[model samples]
Target: MSLALEFVSTVRADRSGPVDTLADVDGLTSWARAHAAGPGFTASEEARQETVRLRQAVRALFARAVAPEPPSRADLPDLPPFKEALALVNATALAAPTAPQLSWDDKPVLVIAPAAETDEPTRLRARLATAAVEFLAGPEVALLRTCPAPRCVLYFVKEHPRQEWCSTACGNRARAARHYREHKK
Candidate 1:
């Protein structure tokens, strides 16, 4: 899966509320390790906080993008979190030495590899941020969708024509709700 999608999947469903995977530094570290293709990332308290902030900003941006209408300039300015997240993403990309390199392999023919620098945490963030920017700016932004299941806060890219839910469980839940409503009547 793309980094943007993986980052968005850090949140899960709950009976009471949404469950955030990056609720702490350890969760953030686990997520980084799983998604990051580069060097081993050392998660710090600061990095975890920044990741949480960025996640919220990205969620807000996704919500706006999937809305029925565009937000006004006044509305945009009020989103200080989004602004700060964008700054961090831009700065990290600018500070990076070089983009990931491609190398030829006997089995796969070609492979893209990350830089061999020690700054794993920064690289991971930059890569994820870049993916998010690309996803939001590209034409596929239209595919960005939130799950329709009740109490579900997850987001997903619509990969198939009939794909309406994020997972089979969500689809089942929607079906069950529809059935209950019909039977109650």
Candidate 2:
């Protein structure tokens, strides 16, 4: 999965209700660490808010990317307008500028990386937004699907011809619900 997809998975629809995994500084810190490809970060109050805003924007865009298909239930109430979401992600991605550098030992490979002096929070947001933009434009967007299990609010890239729900647990939940409905009827 792309970093953007994992970032969006931070929010989930649980049995109790919708859950914002990045609900506070601690949550944000852990999520950043887990997702960080370069270096880990501890989120600040302002950083948390900004990160959440970016997440919302990405989710909103993802909702549209999977158009004609229902979006994650967790994102339903918080999705921003398509244009607004686009602007937010683009701005965030541009906030901390990156430059391309070539690294070669055996072969030459160029990498686009954020400026060294950029703060942790800003770098985090930029990386996330960049990943989201790439993911949305990439071919995998055609494979994204929102899980249909009872109370599921997760999206997944269909891995195979037969894949359905986002996870085994969600598939089980959906099966159970279908069984219950059939038996009840």
Which candidate wins on lDDT?
2
lDDT of 1 by residue, 25-91 (tens): 7788877877764336668888787676666566667667778733222123424465665676566
lDDT of 1: 0.69
**Candidate 1 off by > 4 Å:** 37-39, 69-85, 95-97, 100-118
RMSD of each: 4.7, 1.8
Error of 2 at 22 (Å): 0.7
Model 2, range 1-185, lDDT digits (tens) per residue? Answer: 88999999999887798888889999899888877633456789999999999999999999998889888888688788989999999999988899998999999999976666788899899999999999999999999999989998888999998999899999999999999999994
TM-score of each: 0.76, 0.92
Residue 46, model 1, lDDT: 85
Q: What ranges in model 2 sit over 4 Å off?
A: 37-40, 104-109
